[model samples]
Target: MPQETNIPNKSILTPFNVVAGIIILAGLVITVLRFTKGLGAVTNLDDNNPWGIWIGFDLLCGVALAAGGYVTSAACYIFGLKRYHSAVRPAILTAFLGYALVVLALHYDVGRPWRLPYPIFLSPGTTSLLYEVGLCVFLYLAVLFIEYSPAALEWLGLKKVRNLIVRMTLVLTIFGVVLSTLHQSSLGALFMIAPSKLHPLWYSNYLPVYFFISSIFAGLSMVIFEGTLAHRFLHHKMDATHLRESEGVALGFSKAASFVMMGYLSVKLIGISVDNNWHLLFTGWGLWFLLELIGFVALPAFLYSLAVRERNLRWARWAAALSVLGVVLNRLNISVVAFNWYLPSAQRYVPSWMEIGTSIFIVTLGVVIYRFITTRMPIFYEHPDFRHDI
Candidate 1:
């Protein structure tokens, strides 16, 4: 008989869970306040700065970090890297949840949240880049759900459906890669219309390329980060096979991230050279840009090489953390900081308490949901009955 467990252990009201509960409650209250009182009431947004943390951090960073699903799946299934098969399901679940939370954040950012679905059925703006982003996000969310459904079906003892979904892994992985490529690049394309609005230090005609390439490393780093945490905290739930190869998997991910980071650094420098903005490195923002590139990108790449060469999983985990931070900082720099770099301090956007609280709430909610699913489903490891195949 297959074992089924929900809530995992008896001690549910731990300190972490208590804090998460408070944040979730506060977030729900803030969300209601946002919808009822209007965007102006709970936000610091204005004519000069319409979007805030929700869009910059939650949507942009959220989507980019969630790239683990496609990256791992493509490696395991499409490229026939069977060694990485154990990591695929967890990556997919993370991606699914990450995208779902992005949709929630988008709802708070858009002025008319109710009209979000209008793009799909009622008012199709076929020519807009936003339309493509919206359509791809909607469709890809469905694809992720479908990709992850087999795990849930297996948990529920639906063997027939679980096997059926497992067979579609290749097709689903290919489709996911295509959609992720388009939308990930399109995110950078979103800022192309604002050439003057973006700082020369960051803007480029090759923004789309930067986004796509960096996402590969970003996904790899996330896999390392998430996998490290899982192994430390969820050891009991993980299979022995997964536990044994986990270090090797982390090393492989770090090696790949190192290579991608090198390419990203080269391209970024080339972007600066092409714009003849090398002189900007002397200015404050220019120095910040250099810090991001060298400290975050170059330094981490070097550390990853060291970690892999020495077989230091600890150092690899550190590199992954830095890499994830670098990715988030890059997104925030582009969307929030550089977007209004030329504007005066008085005219620039700053998030209000309500806005900050709401962002916290949304993030907390995602964490809670992740916990719920991991505890209930066969995410950390395969169920015994479903062990022969994923």
Candidate 2:
């Protein structure tokens, strides 16, 4: 049977709920306007900038941050890091929601949302990186669903079914990692087709490598960051194992993320050096690139190192937040900011208020769904009947 949490009935009118309600309502209104009024009514995207924040922030950033699912699960099941097991559930849940929302965000971005499956199913574009990304995302989303199903099954007291899924953990983890690696790198590869459009400093033959490496730290930082939030708002929901291991998970991930960020920074320098874009570093675009590399990447890596050295959870949390921001900054720089660097300010893509609102709406929706699931499921705790199995 599942563990029962003594969750008291709470008011439905809390500040968070009220704000989320408003966002959801606004999202619905925008949804109506978007479908009826078309992309033009809700977005600033044009032929010059067919992709805006919807692709940059929501899709790229969302997928990168969501890498926690594969990272955490791989750490736990595949790498024999059993101490981090408590985090696997929440990480998987976050990734599942993140990918689902990514697909939803695509619907809002495309001219015809209904035709999303056409390229994948009806006429497979095997030669396109996009088709590979689409196929991987589709397959990986299913993999995450299966990875996440044990919690839902356990919550519903389906012991046999839950145990069956649990037995396939290793297989699922391997598959998830393979799929995640393919798509994470492929996303960066998508930008490689337009070298002339993307700024010289940001463009490199190693874009895929950069993206994959950054995602490693991005996923690690997100796990730490999400764990912090869970501990704050949902502390009472956690079992002893989750609560006790939370600090260790944070510290361990901090050390790992710090090292990965250093590697990422090194590779980024190599990319610039290989391309011999040293002269560009003296210019304004180079300054912006350096800021992202040094400020977001290097700084957070140091912070994570400091946190791990001192065994300071607070510093670890801060580093996680900064690293998450760094991933977002990198994705945005590639997809929006740096993509059309030569264009005049008047011609650049700037997301409309409605577009931004829709993003907020999608994120808020994930939060709400997560809250609902965690509050009900055995996500933060092990079920008594299955405690020995895990």
Candidate 3:
């Protein structure tokens, strides 16, 4: 028999929803202008600054933040931490939607998005770092969906299909981990070739290591943040048991985030020492770098440690927010603020209204989709019929 669950009665016209709808509509209009008028018409981009917020915040940070999917999956499936099983579905959904948004934003950023598939099928730029990132992202997105499909199948009461999906979970999770590891590091590798362009404070030969390591904490922090929201707003979608287990999950995330944040800090310091650029610490740019390292990374890491020790979920959530902010700052520093560091201030690129609008559109779309799916599907709670099977 199919599982019986209580679906929440949510109105589609809340204030937040209305604002999201308006932003989405504006973004649609802006997108139309962008396509018809060419990149020059709606963007502040030029030859000196080809990439802006779309590449930095949308594609780069989006991919990094989505790391929760693989982290949660590996924890439950690979490491045999079944206690975390309840979080797996929501994490996977968040990751799948995040990657989808990254791809959608890329469509608006690229000169000709129709050529997106060229690397996969036609041109196959085997020698390019971007090629590796592209292929991994594309394949990983598919893997995320496959991993997440069991929930959808179960929601629809398709027992046979859901069982088939459940059987494939282990294999799919393995693939997700492998693919995520490659592309997460490869994104940093994309900037390695332009060491001269990136600021000394942020540039390093070990950038790939830095990016991959930081993503660990970043993803975990997001899980804590998102999980908190789920417990608050989507409470009706979750079972009492899931609601109870979520507290432990938040504490676990804090513990893991603290350790990873320490390692990331050490690695970041080592990267600076290796480059023999400690002298740059005296510069203005270096001060900003210090603020990022100390204010966001080190401070939040300490908070996570304290929170976990005290078992204070509230403090942990605050730390998680700061940790997420740290990752966003790091990506933006690398891709935009400190990119082309040697160039004059006037030459630095800033996103125009259209670019910002498009980015917001992508985010709002993700939120709407997440809200829709979690409300309708078996995301927050398992289907009773297959709970034992999963």
Candidate 4:
């Protein structure tokens, strides 16, 4: 038998799990109350604001957060930055969870979420950006499941299948990267159609480009953030080599993020200046725009540079985390905040307790699945000599 033992001895009652469970339960209860009543019963949404926090945070923000899977996999498999090999599995897993959550959140908001599949098969719309995103995301999700299958294979003691999946990983990875690039940019394209409705400050012809570039940082940042969480909570599940490998991935990601941020900053400056939208800077939204830029973009880019130069992985991790937050804010601004700029702030979509609860429940479910897979699979740590010569 291969050299192996069961996972570390830790009770399932870790504080994190307990807290997550409560949040989920509370959210579900709220959801039950909403369906029995109506959207008006629990939600603050009205005709003025059709979308709410579920669309802003869970769908838009969550997709950006999930960008890590594509970025890391691209670096390793496409770019052949082999030092980042260790980060690939976790990034893919996170992407799966992040997108999965978006689906769940949208399910709650749609008229008939159960009929979602109908759009895919029965009433497909090829020209719709949302349709493209939907198709691309669905295909990408399948790619992720395929890429992540080795973990399940290992858990089931199917060594042959695990080896086969690893061998075919290059093809699957290439497919995943292409789909991710398309869908991510398509997400930005979704807002582009609402150019007249979006705030003049954020809307531009280069929206797709900004969205794509920002997603690079978002993915990198998510990898760092999620890695920190897992390492802290699953201390006993870690090993020295795994930590060392992950550090290299972090450093590489930080440098890449810095470069991407520099490009993004240039576009923001050029976009606003060329269009003479400087007047918007004097309004309330302008202050928020400035805050988001300085707080999330400029600050984190500088910190990433400092961290990389100083070889300070800790600060780099924090910077990556901040970059991820910036990405989240940027996406939400496009989708919801800037979508209906003329609407009163009070009239904006506000999530009901049910919406919040369901979002939490979906995320918790993802965490549980991630934990369950990591506990028994080869997703986290792989033996250095375990290379398949396929």
- Listed per candidate, the RMSD to the true structure in angstroms reads 3.7, 3.9, 4.3, 4.5
Give the alpha carbon lDDT tens digit for every residue of 1-390 in model 1: 123343454367788888998888888888888889989889999988877888888888898999999999999888887788888888999999999999989998898978999999899998887898899989999999999998799789999988998898889999999999998888888888889888988899888888888888999999999998887777788887788768878998889899989998888888888889989889999989988888888989999999999999999999999999999999889888889889999999888988889878877887778777887888877788988775
Q: List residue ranges in candidate 1 displaced over 4 A.
A: 1-10
Which candidate should be chosen as best, given lDDT against the real structure? 2
lDDT over C-alpha atoms for residue 266 of model 4: 93
lDDT of 3 by residue, 130-242 (tens): 99999999999999988888888888889888788888898999999999999999999899888788997898989999899988898999999998888789998998668
Candidate achieving the largest TM-score: 2
**In candidate 1, which residue pairs clash?**
none
Q: List the residue pairs that clash in candidate 3.
A: none
- Please give each candidate's TM-score: 0.96, 0.97, 0.96, 0.91
Report the C-alpha displacement of residue 289, candidate 2, in angstroms: 0.6
- At residue 376, candidate 2 shows an lDDT of 96
Q: Output the TM-score of candidate 2.
A: 0.97
- Tally clashes: model 3: 0
lDDT tens digits by residue: candidate 2, 4-34:
3323324667889989999999999999999
